[model samples]
Target: MIGKRLKRLSPAIGRAYIQLIMELDERISEISATQLQKQLKCGPGCDGCCIQFSVLPLEAAIVAEAAVAKNVNAENNGESCSLLKDGLCSVYEVRPVICRTQGLPLAYIDEEAGAIEVSACPVNFPDDYPLSHDELMFMDSYNGRLAQLNVQYCTENDIDCSVRIPLADCVC
Candidate 1:
């Protein structure tokens, strides 16, 4: 369904969406290689955090297109993400931004607390592990860029940017 909707949109918008995701993936790779690889416990077959979630229309469209191309069907086990098959993501290559940064040192502003908080998977990092500012992946910057791209895509495609589509619906 999302693929069909994307067909009517401008190809340029699609390219931009893909470019943003690619750039994010590259950043994640660089971080993993330079800093997080030793502490990162995430790897294939570790689907503990593969839970169901919603995504923006631009993200849904790209994931849906990839699923369609790969002839993969989402199987909702009612406990985890529909995109997971045999404990691995069926559409791993084109997964959404959130999935790309899982288990990494994520930093975001805690507005209510008026400070920045950094977090990572407990299994990946010990409770006493000291997180460094330089190693933290500040999410706000990337999320802001994604929001900008999403707005452009949604405006052109007539999608409600505020309405997030479930990940399962993307595959369907």
Candidate 2:
């Protein structure tokens, strides 16, 4: 299932897939934001979860292109994300995949434990509102699809496949 259409994708098609994935993630985030607005503390000025994190190489590559176009630096200061400027994400328009999931109910299927681990920021879920597993955003499926797309991208571009780079490293 992974490599069925490996080399069939052109860079243009790969870019389209990346855009579609980003749109889907944004749509899901919007749903969560609307449904849990009362319980969610995340807002424009909230950078609580904007700490350093890694993103897939494909994400980094895309963001790197944006960084150059925007004339913004993507350096890592070994503190908070270098993208933050004046308490806001400088590259918010092209933020990485992990940045899109902050302050949302996220679920991960642990195969070894055979259970779905669900969690969100402590500020969320204060009202004991029951959220079904299907209601939460699942990372496994998203990540798998991303990996598949990344494989196609790498294959088409002759880049290394299956690599995760620090967000800072990707830009500069």
Candidate 3:
């Protein structure tokens, strides 16, 4: 299937992506990190957000760059995401900002002022469990980032570049 316009950005474009990613990551990490409060130790194998997601060009590029840097076999392995080697994101270090900011509830920056209430995915917790307040906060923030990042990438690349599909459907 011939996909949408593959926006070919310049080096500046790549840097912009990395910058946005880094900034977003830093802010979220500051907030969510405090909220998580060492919940990670109890969250082993808890990849609740990985299976149900898609990414923007900037995001895809970030993942591709990481795969290249780490020498991940993409042509043969990208079908399921190079990061998904052991049914999980292998390159977590260079994982997209969304991956870094998943599974939390949040009060996001309102267009007006301060923060507002938001909800998290019910499935963030195990089937027999429910997400904690911190988890829900993180999930809202993560989804907001997903929406904003795609818009920025599209604007920079001179295209709408907005399409919601399976994660497997997206490609560079």
Candidate 4:
């Protein structure tokens, strides 16, 4: 039953990418509650992150999976996103990585400077609440590994990688 739904929603022939997001979201929620409460106090109607071109591998997959799971038309969730409802994440328990980690700081290797600096999420305030040690390690381990999913989608169909369209525009 799950396999058939995934086959339809999944961009590739055999990739359960949405499951990854579902797992990560649960982990992040427990690991970053203090930070979420103190700094990333985002409430309803604060979807600044959604407006930008930042579709993490798992996020795109869950939206796709939700559509297929529901037999939605147009390869769309038809609800902006299966997780989103009235400016809130209805599926917060199994929300996507974008929602879980969006309210946090991001540190990346500075190729030029060779240093790691804190880059806060546009909707988050890391200066007020820094991430813990375990959180950093978990994020590091979760390195952006969705590049393959993109390649798989492109190889399977005529997917436009550069298209960063809005959810409202894309949803059926």
Candidate 5:
């Protein structure tokens, strides 16, 4: 379903795409928390999943912009994440989409299996609460949009978009 004009969109498209993604992520998180019978266990100072993770080039660039704006020089010396300062994300406001969705119940369609798989952080859903596909954040759509935006970005810059860099590499 590629549009005629979007095949040549600007690199700044990532900013807009990421903004919408984050807003939807927030709404999904809120909905998940309300639908679940238990409270979300993740909170401030919970840096357990903030380890080494790879992000798309567009995502890394967006995070890097936020880090620069906030003057967040946490130093990415190859330790987990460069944005982490004493177990707290220095660029929390502009954290990547994955960071925003951590610990939340979500669903992704297993392309090969042709089935929807729902999951969340172990700390969450401890009671084995039953959740339907609609009740969870469907990641396939959001991820597709992100990938599309990345392609547009790469095409605009004449670079390969498939490369994913570590979070530390971006923040530093």
Candidate 6:
């Protein structure tokens, strides 16, 4: 099922998307090592945040490719992620950006508040945890890059740039 969708995307876009994902993973690892060491509570068996979500066509295509490669036939578990099997992500290696950064300190510009706000999973950080500015991952930068790549992918694939594909639908 997913193979058909994967066929629509060019290999160049796939390589670019994978490169971006790799860079994001590297950055997350760097931050985790320097800022979140001994603080991150997320690991195997942590599925609280593993819920159904939407992704760009580029992301969906990459995920679909991974699912096909892994021979994953994920069944949507209501509100939970379809990729979850045996309490672990079956597509962990090619999981989306959101999954990669979950439980980590995220910083976003609160448009209404006109200020920067930082947040993390309640279980991962203490209420009084003194979060440094450098420790927080600014999502805007990464998201912007992802969006740009998605736009390029969509343009090349003749897909709507605004189209958001459900993660579960990526699995065969």
Q: Where is model 6 poorest over a 10-residue stretch in terms of lDDT?
A: 1-10
Per-residue lDDT of candidate 6, residues 1-172 (tens digit): 5435644557776677778888888888888998578898789999999998988888888789888889998786889999999779999987889999999999999899999988798898988998888888889878988899889888887789898988888987
Encode model 2's per-residue lDDT on 51-165: one tens digit a residue: 7777765676666666666777765545788777767888787786678777778889999999988877767665476876556777787777778877767776676786666
Q: What's the ranking of the predictions by TM-score, best on top?
A: 6, 1, 5, 2, 4, 3
- What is each predicted model's overall lDDT from 0 to 1? 0.83, 0.69, 0.54, 0.49, 0.70, 0.84
TM-scores of the candidates are 0.89, 0.78, 0.56, 0.57, 0.81, 0.89
Clashes, model 1: 0
Question: How close to the true structure is residue 129 of candidate 3, measured as C-alpha lDDT?
Answer: 46
Q: After superposition, how far is residue 19 of candidate 6 from its true place, in Å?
A: 2.8
Model 3 — which ten-residue stretch has the worst lDDT?
1-10
Model 3 segments more than 4 A misplaced:
1-9, 32-35, 38-44, 68-82, 108-115, 121-160, 164-166, 169-172
Tens-digit lDDT track of model 4 for 1-172: 2212222334343345555555566676665664455555566767555432335333454555554455444323343453355565543443445456665665566658976666566556535655665544145434445555555654454555454433322224
RMSD of each: 2.0, 5.8, 5.7, 6.3, 6.1, 2.0
- 10 residues in a row with least lDDT, candidate 5: 1-10
Worst 10-residue lDDT window, candidate 1: 1-10
Q: Considering only N, C-alpha and C atoms within 3 Å, which residue pairs clash in candidate 1?
A: none
Model 4 worst lDDT window (10 residues)? 1-10
Q: How many clashes does each candidate structure show, in the order listed?
A: 0, 0, 10, 0, 0, 0
- The better-scoring model by lDDT among 1 and 4 is 1
- Which candidate do you rate higher for lDDT, 5 or 6? 6
- Using TM-score, give the best candidate's number: 6
